[model samples]
Target: MTEAVHLATARVGDLAAVMRVMDAAFDPLFGEAWSGAQLLTLFALPSARVCLAWHGEEPCGFSAARIAGPESELLLLAVDPAWRGRGIGRLLLDDWQAWASAHGADDYFLEMRADNDAAHLYSRAGFVEVGRRAAYYRGNDGQMRDAITMRQRPSPKSGD
Candidate 1:
C-alpha cells in the first residue's frame, strides 16, 4: 500500500470543502437532486463528527458520522477518484471508528443506494446488510432507487 495519508479531525471552517468532496462523490449516484447545502445540513447535526484526509496540503477524501447513544451512523464517506485504491478510505474509517469508540459508540451503521458499487467496500470492512428499503431514492432523472442498510458491531473490547 502507498504511504498512509494524514487524517485529522475536521474543523467547522472546513465545512464548505467537505461538502464539495461529498457533492463530487455522491452526485453520480444521486445526481443533481440533492444540493450541497442539503447534504451539509444533514451532516451538521450536533452528534456528527467529520474527518478530512489530506495528501500533503491537498484535500483528497472525507468521512462523516454521528454518534448517538450506543449507535453511530456513517453519514458519508468519499475519496477523490484520483486518490482511490490508496487505502485512504480505510484510513478514514479507522479514524472514524476510533472517534466513535471514544464517544461511546458500540455499533456502526450506514445506508447506501442498493445499486451503489461501493457497497463492496463496506462489506469488505465487515459491514453486514441488515435491511433494504425499496424505492427510497428519487434520482434526478425521476427514477426510483432502492436503499440498503448495513451495520457493523465493534468487538466488545475493541471499541472500549
Candidate 2:
C-alpha cells in the first residue's frame, strides 16, 4: 500500500519549496507564473493562506488562496512535474475549500487562461463558468488569451 500524502498549512518560510513547484508546474506560455517577491507580498496579507502537500520528505504540491468577506479566490495551485497524476491537485482543492469555509467564505473563485487543461479539474470540483475576461493575459508566444472565471459554493452537509 502507498503511504498517505500529508497536507500542512504552509508558511512564508516555505516559499522556496512552493516556488520550485510553481516554476516546474507552469509554463511561461501560460502567463500565470508569479515571481518570488510577488508571492512574498501576497503571503503578507492576513486573508491569504497557503497549503503544501508533502509525500514523506518531498514537497509534492501546493495551493494558495485569499479569503475576504464572503468570497475566496484561489490564486495558484501547482504540483511538481514528477507528481502530476496522483490526485494532488484535487487534494489541494479540497483543503483550500475547507480552509476558506472555516474562515467564513461562502463562494470560491478562480480564473485561468481558457486554454488551460485544468478546466476539467475545476469543473469536477463543482466550479462553473461565472464570467470571462477578454484578452486577459499575454503569453510568451506573444499571443493573448481569454480568461475564464469559475465559481463554486460548498454544498451543505446533511446535518447542517
Candidate 3:
C-alpha cells in the first residue's frame, strides 16, 4: 500500500495487462470476469472507457465504464487480490466519476452480486442501493445469486 502506483487510460495494446489483473482479481466460480474479446469489443465502443493501474511495471488493477446521455454505468472495477485493501479500487472509482463528470454524466449506476464484499466499498463511496434483480447471476458453480443495483447522483454544488 505504501508503494507508488500509477493509473492511466488503457489502450487496446494494454489488453494483456488488463486481463492479467482481471484473471487474478475475479474468481472464475463467480463468472464475473470478461473475456479479452469482450473487452476488445468494449474498447471499440465510442462511449466506453477503460483505465489501468500499475504498481511500478506490474499491472495491478483496472476499471471500465460506459456512458449514455446523462448516465454512466460502471462495467467493472477490479484490483488484483494482492493489491486489495490498498485503495486501488477507490482510486479507480474516483477516476471513473471524474471522467464521467467531465463527459456530462449526472448519474452513475452499477450492479454486483448481492453478497459481494465490495458493496461496503461502494456504500462508502456514496452509492445507494436502488434496486435488485432476483437470481440474476448464474455462477459457474451453478449457484444463482441476486444482483444488487446501486446508483449515485452527483452531489449538488456547495452553494445550491
Candidate 4:
C-alpha cells in the first residue's frame, strides 16, 4: 500500500495477470482457486468483466463479475494477504460497482462462505444479508460451511 494502486478493466489477454493475483490471494490449502481454462471460458462470455488492482506492475488484487439485465453478481473478489487491510480490496469493489452501474445494473449481488472474514468488508460497503444456503461450501479440511448471500443497491443518480 505504499505506492498508489490503480484499477484496470481486464481483457482476455490479461488472464495471466488475473490468475497470478488469484493464485497468490487464495490459499492453496483451500484448493478453491480457479484454473486458467475456466477463467478463459468466463472471459469469453459477453457479460463477463474483471477489474484488476495493481501495485507497481504486480497484480495485488482483482474482482471477477458479470452483468445480466438489472442485476450484477460478483463471482470473485481476492486480495493478496500482504495487501489485505490496506484498502486494495475496497478499491477493486468500487471499480466493479461503477462498471456494473454503467452497464445498467442497479442491484449488486454476491455470495461468500459464512466463515470468511471479508464479510465485514462487504457489510461496510452497504451490502445487506439477503439469503443463506446451509452447507454450501465444502472446505479442503472436509468441513461443510454455509454460504451467505448479500445485496447492495445504490440509489439512483439524478437524471440517471
Candidate 5:
C-alpha cells in the first residue's frame, strides 16, 4: 500500500461508510453483500465486532467478526475495489485476528466460497481448511458453490 491506512472500531453510525466499501468490493453476481438492515442488526450483537479501515477521511475497507467462548468467526471482509491490491485486506485480517486474540479467542474461523481468491490470503495467514459444505451458497447466476471452512490456531511459542 503506497498510502498510509489505519483501522478503528466501527460504530453503527458508520454504517454508510462501511456499506460503501462493501457495495464496491463485493461482486453482485456472488450475492455476498449483506443488506444495510442486516448489518445494523449485527452491530446490536454483543459478541460481534467491526473494524473499519480508513485512508485519510475515506473508508477503504472493513472486517466484521464474532467471538463466542474461545472461538471467533469472520463474518465479512471487504476492501473498496478501487483501493484493492494494496494490502488493505491483509491489514483487516491481521486486525481481526488481533482483536479476537485480545478478546480471549484461542482459534479463529472463517468460511468462504470454495472458489474465492481470498482463500490464498487466509492460507498465508496460517488458516487451514477444516471442513466444507457442498452447494452451500447459491449465486445470482443460479450456480451453487461449495463453502470452505478454515481455522487458525495460535502458533507455538519459542519454548514449549
Candidate 6:
C-alpha cells in the first residue's frame, strides 16, 4: 500500500522543484516547453500562488494559480507519473480553491486541452465546462487540439 502524500504551500526555495513538476506534467500535453527562466518569472509574479505535494521531502506534485481582478486562474497542476491516481491532485485543487477564496476571489477558472485525461479531475472538483477554443494547442506531434475552459463559483460566504 502507498502512503498518503503531504500538501503544503510552496516556499520561495521550492521554485525549482515546482518547475520540475510543471515541466513533467505539461510537456506531453502542451508540447511548448517552459524554460527555467520562464519558471522563475512565474514564481516571481506577485499574483501567483503555488502549492506542492511532497512524499518525504521530494516534490511529487504541484499546482499553480494567478489571481487577477475578481477571478483566479489555475495555471498548472501536475502529479508525478508514479504518484498519479493517489488524490494528490485533488488535495492541491482543494487547497487552491480555499486559498483563492480567502484572498477575495469569487470565481475560479482554468484551461486544459480538450483531449487531456485530467479533465475529469477538474470536473470532479466542481468546475463546469463553459467554453472551448478550436486548434488551441499545436502538439509536438504536429497535431492541433481544442482547449476546454472550465469555471467554478465560490461559495458566497466562503469568499468573504
The C-alpha TM-scores of every prediction are 0.85, 0.92, 0.95, 0.91, 0.94, 0.87
lDDT of 4 by residue, 1-160 (tens): 6358988888888998999888888876556688988888777888988888888798889999999998999999999888888998889888888888899988999998887888999999999999999998888888888999999976877999
- Local distance difference test, each candidate: 0.80, 0.88, 0.93, 0.87, 0.92, 0.82
Q: Model 2, residue 54: what's the lDDT?
A: 89
Q: Of the candidates shown, which would achieve the greatest TM-score relative to the real structure?
A: 3
**Poorest lDDT segment (10 consecutive residues) of candidate 6:** 27-36
Off by over 4 Å in 3: 157-160
Better of 1 and 3 by TM-score: 3
- Candidate 4 local lDDT, residue 88: 88
lDDT of 5: 0.92
Residue-level lDDT tens digits of model 3 in 1-160: 7248888899999999999999999999999999999999988998999999999889999999999999999999999999999998999999999998899998999999999989999999999999999999999999999999999977788899
Off by over 4 Å in 2: 1-3, 154-160
Q: List the residue pairs that clash in candidate 3.
A: none
RMSD of each: 3.1, 2.4, 1.5, 2.3, 1.6, 2.8
Q: How many residue pairs collide in each prediction? A: 0, 0, 0, 0, 0, 0
Off by over 4 Å in 6: 1-3, 27-29, 156-160
- Candidate 5 matches the true fold with a TM-score of 0.94
RMSD of 6: 2.8
Compared with the true structure, the alpha-carbon lDDT of candidate 2 equals: 0.88
Number of clashes in model 3?
Answer: 0
Distance from true position, residue 60, model 6, in Å?
Answer: 0.6
In candidate 3 the C-alpha lDDT for residue 121 amounts to 92
lDDT of 6 by residue, 63-150 (tens): 8888987799998788877788888888889888888878878799999889888889988888999999999889988899999899
Distance from true position, residue 66, model 6, in Å?
0.6
